[model samples]
Target: MSAAWSAGCVRARSMLSRRVGAGGARELASRASLEEVLQQLAAGPYQRGIRPGQSLEDAQRAVAATVLWHLRVLAGWLPREGAESVRALAGWFEVANVVEQVQQPGTPPYLLGSLAVSWPRLARAASPEQMREELAASPWGDPGGSDPRTIAVGVQFAWAVRVAERVPRAQDWAAGGAALLFARERFLAEQPLAEPAVRRAAVLLGADAVGSASFADLRARLRGDARWVLSDVDGPGELWRAEVRWWDRVARDALKLLRTTGFGPDVVVGCAVLLGVDARKVRAALEISARGGRPLEAFDVLA
Candidate 1:
């Protein structure tokens, strides 16, 4: 391995070591109050993002911010191509920023800093049309049209494609995510598939799958690794489990990647995914704690 790859892999593993493991997260959930949860987090890697007495939404965003910061640090340790791959994975933040910009322009955007694909330019967009134009000019490509919903969905599909193209190992992850997106629109939200979404789905999952008439049909249309994400999902109410299963699958695959790969981008990517999974588990645990639910209650959604 090159010196940069070696250093980056080392940094990745070090960052992974700092995660609050599944057991630790469950323990946090078992705490008596959010106060106790916050106290526990203050002594860990989350201390930088979390604070005393923050609302659940704010606290979750803080956790996400901290994870993004970690990704930025990891990216700094890598060479050009590896850093670009990290940046591709990090595009989800940029996608969130854009969606928030369209849905609630007054909301303050997440500070993406060096990991941004086009937030610097997109932030200045005064209208959805301007945002669409800015995205077309940037790495995100055209958002189909200026409709806020279309723009939101377009950017997400674009992010998935970017990840698949830039980090080949993440192809299954990207496909699985896109399949879930389709399921959400069709089953959970019960909204008709818009033209832009249909086009994107056709491109991502193929023509036959895009024409799925129901959730069962959609799940049946998926092949190979992408099909497994929806294997246990039966209906809209069960969609949450599909998301939970997605996280579980990601953690499992990422761990395997970490074990099999040496000093390379795969190691860095695996580490990044694991960090994301840990952060998500922590956030879920905090949610359960805030609700005064038992720790075991969290395992249903978290396990």
Candidate 2:
């Protein structure tokens, strides 16, 4: 392999290992290599193209071809029963046409609740065809199979926090899990989607950070308490609106309740119940930071 291709593979492996679990790492890495091959073919000779910068659309399409190839190749690794696994990864990738078709830009805010339901099953698809069939079976239709290449850019565009939420707890080095949790928030904020539930995932993920959200998701979460109705959030490079009426309600009058807090331990564990993030990851991270370093933390890291 050329040095450039080799380096790209290395970068792909490192990121995939972080994004997916160790179980899927090698396969994901190999798929990334194959993706580079596909991209070179589709974009013309890779060596010649690199000397001169390509147009934005060309660069975008090339990167997209890489993401689709990886998605298809990685999904191929699953067992017949691994549909759920494949589906989750696909959800992590958040194919764009699905996002665009389902959501509108100006709607109520929302959270990850409804969106999270699809992820586990989405990750389970055994092949690209299977992935396409699965999404088609849902309300989203078959965005992948109909025009796989055309939509891959949209897929990369849509991934965001939906991907970060999938990171297994064992991957985080910090005991507090703060870094990974923080990372998830940042990813969503960085690529905040128009979808409310997805937007809420980022909002619930971080407090001081920025991200966009439709009012629908925000209102859905605000079924109760409130000192405030809406707040400005930071997204990719700008500020967007989010509502926190309920959060303010709990923080102000309902503050004394031990179980009421959303940002602390019990809440984190409860979030684990809802979000499927391993509590050990969060606890381990907290402990590591608190103690500076220890054996249990290492064991948790290994977990």
Candidate 3:
């Protein structure tokens, strides 16, 4: 590895030690209340963003914000190429900003600083047409059209494509996620895939498979790693489990990458993915705690 990547990899691995692992998240889930959860997290890496009295939505956003901040710090240690890869993964934050901008104008953005893709330009957009124009001019590219719902789906697909292009190892994960996005729209939401969405899915899943009428049809049509994401998902009610399984798959794949790869972009990406898994686990735990449910029940799908 180059000296810069070597240094960045070292930093990435070191950051992994800061995560509240599965065990810690389970413990947090066992807490009696959100206050207890926050009190326990007060001394951790997430302490800055998560605080007492924040609503569940605010706390979830805080978890994401904390993860983004780590990505920003990690990017600073990387070379230009390595930093670009991290930046591509960080596009989720930009997508979130765009979604919020389309859904609710003037809500404060996630504060991405230098890691931003198009938030600076997107923030200034006063209407959907302006938003589409700005996105077309930026790296995110048009998001297909200005319709808020279509734009949301389009940006997500764009983010997946960008990540797959920059981080080749993440191609399967990106495609799997895109597959799930289509599945959710088709099954859980009971909505037909929008024309733009179908067109985007065709890029990764092929035109023949994108029009599958049922989960079984879609699963049979898929011939790549993306198919496994829906392995045992029978219907809409179990879709939540499919999502949980997706994260489980991500966590497993990331761990394997960390264990098998030397100090390189794969290791950096692996570290980032693992951190994301931990953040999601923590968020789930907080939700359970806030609802006064059994602590371990928060992860029932994993069982």
- Full-model lDDT for every candidate: 0.84, 0.32, 0.83
Q: Report the CA-based lDDT of candidate 2 relative to the real structure.
A: 0.32
| TM-score of decoy 2 | 0.27
**Candidate 1 lDDT trough over 10 residues, lowest sum:** 294-303
Question: Candidate 2, residues 1-303: lDDT per residue as tens digits?
Answer: 334333333333333322222222222223323333233334432222222234333433333334434434433433332223334434533454333333422222212232243544544554555555666565334444333332232243233232234333211111112222222333444332333323333333333222324332432333221102332333222211221222223233322322452222222112212211221222223233233334443423332
| Tens-digit lDDT track of model 1 for 1-303 | 799999999999999877999989888888767878888788898999788888888887888888999999999999998899899999989999999998988877778788888899989999999998998898888877898987988888888778878899998888888888888877888866657567766666767887888888888888565777788788767888888778777888899889965799779999999988888888888888888858566555664
C-alpha positional error of residue 188 in candidate 1 after TM-score superposition, expressed in Å: 2.6
Taking the tens digit of each residue's C-alpha lDDT, what string does model 3 give over 1-303? 789889999999999987889888888887778888887787797997988888888887898889999999999999998888888988999999999998988777888887888788789998888888898888777667787887788789888878878888888888888888888878778766556567767777767678788877887787486788888888767778778788878889999888956678788889889888888888888887888747475455542
RMSD of 1: 1.9
The TM-score values for the models, in the order shown, are 0.93, 0.27, 0.93
Clashes of 3: 0
User: How would you order the candidates by lDDT, starting with the best?
Assistant: 1, 3, 2
Assess candidate 3 and give its lDDT: 0.83
In lDDT terms, how accurate is model 1?
A: 0.84
Error of 1 at 44 (Å): 1.0
